[model samples]
Target: MAGIDNIMAAIPGGSTRRFYGTAHWDGARWWAKLGDGPNNLLDAWWQDPVQPLQGGKIAVDITKDEYGQAASFVIGGYTDQPRPSSGTVQEIIPAGVATQIVIMGEDAVAYTTDRFIGEYSPGDPVYLTWDAAKPTVIGKIGASAPPPTPDAPVLVPTNPPGSETLIATASDTYWAPGGWGSYSTSRNGGEDIYTGTWYGNTVTGAWFYGAQRPALQGKTISRIRFRLPARIRGAGNYNDIAIVHFYAHTSGARPGGDVARVTGPHDIPVPPGFAGGDVDLPLSFAPALVAGGGISIAGNPYTGFNSRLKDANSGRLIIDWSS
Candidate 1:
């Protein structure tokens, strides 16, 4: 028997519009009264009452037997809000009572809504556009890993007889000499002659340069050639003697573990009339050049013999190889 004013005062936000009161059982069923103020409408609801109350709008909880169903109605509440235009799938609930999904968009804002458009896993790109006045999911773009590339055979050009491709070349200078020890210069014979003396020790008389040939990496070295104006100097019969030794290193300083070696003095003596000529020695030892490594060449005179290698402007060490 609670009056309208008493019911409005008993509930939250008393005397406000749509002010509802606590529910109770009037012996037969559950009943809740609401106040609509003076000159406004009165409201009442019941779960299992047979008679209607006087002077009020009556509403009943019709879904009393349905499990997990909401029994009350709200005027300005929404079950799901509008999502953004574009986002990425953050999570998905496929087999739950409420099948829904979560997405993340700009400013890292997250939104959870029922999956209405398509099936999506996590990290799937989604685009939503307004269609017929409703936000509808239009497309899903997924990023998959690319396929691996297969190894192909390297194409090598066929050169004519006695022709070769120059992989790398290094020259010598009298001023720097470039790691060549026991170096001496003689200008007494009207021409400047450079000499790198070898004393059987591997540390002395060698020249090295950077051997990072990107084009020659992983390629088979078919042949190697050396071109240097050299001679057996001093008062000894050192004809047809091995004077220079070529090597390869993985890193740092000359003569560091010979990865490949090529000997000089191929039984052909120095040219007549000329002081020294190009000692052309073609080597047939084919070694596969390892990646990230370098090449080096050092003078290794036969035991006790002392030799001289001269570079007057146009001297070079050449490497000929196949791809």
Candidate 2:
């Protein structure tokens, strides 16, 4: 169902308007406080806290005039009131069968593509009726509708499972092993970074990304593992290692700790070199698997001297650290 806005009371005029704490049908006229204190009129639906009538419901001798129409009611109802967007709504329906859907907008109970009868506009008073198959042009709202396209799969950390810690100078690469290609982190591509302050058991200065910020900042990461993809050689592409490089510092700003340098090739080293041999580079990340500054790919070191690594085949540098 989309939503439930306001419910307008359908009351009749001329009747003595009286606030009723709790009105019960007494054969003839529904009796209650005829005005004199706080319990003078029916409470607002949104204000009321009670279960509504159900199938084959009925309301008799209800005031049908203009003035004494609206009565007490609540805002959301149907399933446990405050409905969940990913929840399901099941009604006996004139046909019968539970149809699940994701509600989108307000007045959701009034909309149902199938077996749609009529809709209850916002602010409509609750009217009791005992006709499960009432043939009326109205139907209760279903669950919220789903989006048109498939949603991107959420990125759930498999390795470290929490914050990752790396020495300011170390070039350690944390890769999620076991061929997990389906998952992707919200922390993809380049993002802004923030540093933390360490105190006691906690060492401050943990860098963070803006878009996909870590669950907590400055969290002492026990350990981290990068989930890497198993690269397959294309037609002409050889089974060579793709070298990854690491930089001690991205910009001129270096965070306190001394830079831990990686003295190795940026790209994954090929056994027989890049001479197109049967021997494979075997994409291994053994070198920079410890607390260090940052890991990068490429043989040629840029401005600030730091750690560098590369893929043996593609040579495309992959960042395998939690900054």
Candidate 3:
């Protein structure tokens, strides 16, 4: 599933809106006032807070409809954070620790940083995720943050056990030649990269040039994602498609070995108007596929061409380096 901000951005009509507030308990009812300063501190709503009020000051997000009706709420989250991007760790709690670090310009602890904030020299840049009154840091600027659990369900297995996920787009994507040869010699080269196999209705086994992305140059891939718009080849026929092969090539120019594969009629009864979602295929390379940094990928369908991944660069690959 897409994040809240991502979802909101996708919505064309702005019927619903969100507001930030500072929560409080007015004797009995849990209430929150706008964070826009004392002069404009309007009580947005009086709803149950999301988390235990560890500290007296708790940040909250109120979700309301156009008519000022708050439907839900979020606590100590990104919606109320003072800093939206990277900030310097001005002061650590125990002089060197990052449990609670203050931003360079702030008078209070900006975030309850990650345990693996990585040896910061008191004033290192770090990303953060607000989790109530305690915002969590993303780690040192150089290291990637581990989103162990996916924000929401995309395809199969709501939350892949893997800690890190990197989305990479396919580069040099095109239809493989009648004869599998060099990538440059394809019919549609140097264009938007696309992937997936096509076991044609005709006896021609013309697969995609292969799903290769430059962003995923030399990393070890542990999972791959593809959009499955279950629109079959011909309306009358029941294509018992089995395996969707996921290929990644770290050595050669084209996709070589299988990075992952899933076999099933997962979307059997293709709905009325071709409605289907994403699916995450898991990868398994024995003996720990420890390459330099990242891994590139490519793949084709088992039967008919049935992948709906085409957004200039929307292909996604997950690496087990835990990001």
lDDT, candidates in the order shown = 0.39, 0.26, 0.38
The collision pairs in model 1 are none
User: Model 3: per-residue lDDT, tens digit, 101-128?
Assistant: 6664243444444443446667777766
Ranking by TM-score: 3, 1, 2
As a whole number from 0 to 100, the lDDT of residue 268 in candidate 3 is 25
lDDT of 1 by residue, 1-323 (tens): 45544533443321113333333435665444443333222333232212333332333221111122122221221113353688887787764433787777543677666645656778877886543223445568554556656686666657422323332233221223333332333222212223234442233222333455565555556555544444424311222223345443343223423333333323432321123433444443223223333333444332121122234322333555555
What lDDT score goes with residue 165 in model 1?
34
Question: What does candidate 1 score on TM?
Answer: 0.28
222-313 per-residue lDDT for model 2 (tens digits): 33332222222220112222333323223212333422344433232221012222211222322333222232333221111111122122
C-alpha TM-scores of all predictions: 0.28, 0.18, 0.28
Point out where model 1 deviates above 4 Å.
1-204, 235-315
Error of 1 at 278 (Å): 5.2
| Each candidate: RMSD | 36.9, 26.9, 16.2
- Model 2 lDDT, full chain set: 0.26
User: What would the C-alpha RMSD of candidate 1 be, to one decimal place?
Assistant: 36.9
TM-score of decoy 2: 0.18
